[model samples]
Target: MVRPKEFDERVALTAAMQVFWEKGYEATSIGDLTERMQIARPSLYATFGGKKELFETALRAYVELSLTYVENKLRSMPSVKASFLAYFQGVIEGSGGSNPDFGCLCVNTMVELAPHEPVFAQITEEFEARLTELFRKSIEGGIQSGELPDQLNPSSIARVLTLTAIGLTVTMKMKPSPSRVEHVAAEILTLLE
Candidate 1:
């Protein structure tokens, strides 16, 4: 009879995700994953295939969780503008204003691995497209509700906002001055007007 696994896969995957989020794919070693995941190398291979596969799995989980967080934040306020402001503000503040900022896992992957790795490129690209769609829907709602000008182009504005978010997230990784970052975010929100 086959033996049952001793470790919890979800908990192990979460640990691996944290390791990857802290150290990019290249920088992370199998030893690092095994250690953080608290599983032996054989168990790692048996459970997750290998480092590349594990990274892919971890990244997909991060993508889903990130999108859910964004969707929930966007829907939190009745006013679309307020919702967006709060979303951007949450990004600026960095995980309830307590945790050390890692920027964003998807954006980090886009910068670190997407250009050379087709799989990562596709994953990150899909993430951006989804975020843009979310923004587009919210903007369309604003237009329908008469909160935004009818002539404004939702697609164009959504793309710009997505790019702005990407740029802001990358900038935040460098730990710039808080006031300057907030100023830049405020200026970006003016695009909604």
Candidate 2:
């Protein structure tokens, strides 16, 4: 019988995700993953199959956690407008924390690999669609609660927020200024009126 490896899978995957997020998919090498993961090639292959599989796994993990976070926060918050602003504030706080230019791991994968990879394109599209739905739900809740005007379109505002998120992610990677992002987010939230 074969014995399982001693390393922690969660730690390894998180480390690999960070590397991929920082350097991107095409730029991240097997050596880099192994180095960051603190595991040998055989162990990595045994655990995740290979680099592409590992990257896919990492992307899925990131998406799941991030989506859950967004969902939980938006759902629990009292004000729809405050929920969206808090979401952007989370983004700003995260961006300024560790690797300043880390941006978003899933967003990075989408921009770097989705164009040439159908699977990645689909995954990215689904992620964006779900995000849009979250925003739409919040907007709808706001309308029902008399917090927002009746004439406002939830679908349209949701799409706009989704688009703004993509742009903001890229901008963070380039500039990584929390204040600037926060200012832009505050301005964007004014549309809630």
The global Cα lDDT (0 to 1) of model 1 is: 0.89
Residue pairs clashing in model 2 are none
| lDDT, residue 12, model 1 | 99
Q: Please give, for residues 1-193, the per-residue lDDT of candidate 2 as tens digits.
A: 9887789999999999889888888899999999999999999999999888998899988888878878987876788888888777666556324343788776887788999988888888999999999899999999999999999999999999988887877777787545666687688897788
Tell me the whole-model lDDT of each prediction, alpha carbons only.
Answer: 0.89, 0.84
What is candidate 1's lDDT per residue for 83-115, written digit by digit as tens?
Answer: 888888777878643233678889999999999
RMSD of 1: 1.5
- Mark the regions of model 1 whose C-alpha exceeds 4 Å error after superposition: 96-100
Estimate the Cα RMSD of every predicted model relative to the unseen true structure: 1.5, 2.1
Tell me the deviation in Å of residue 77 in model 1.
0.6
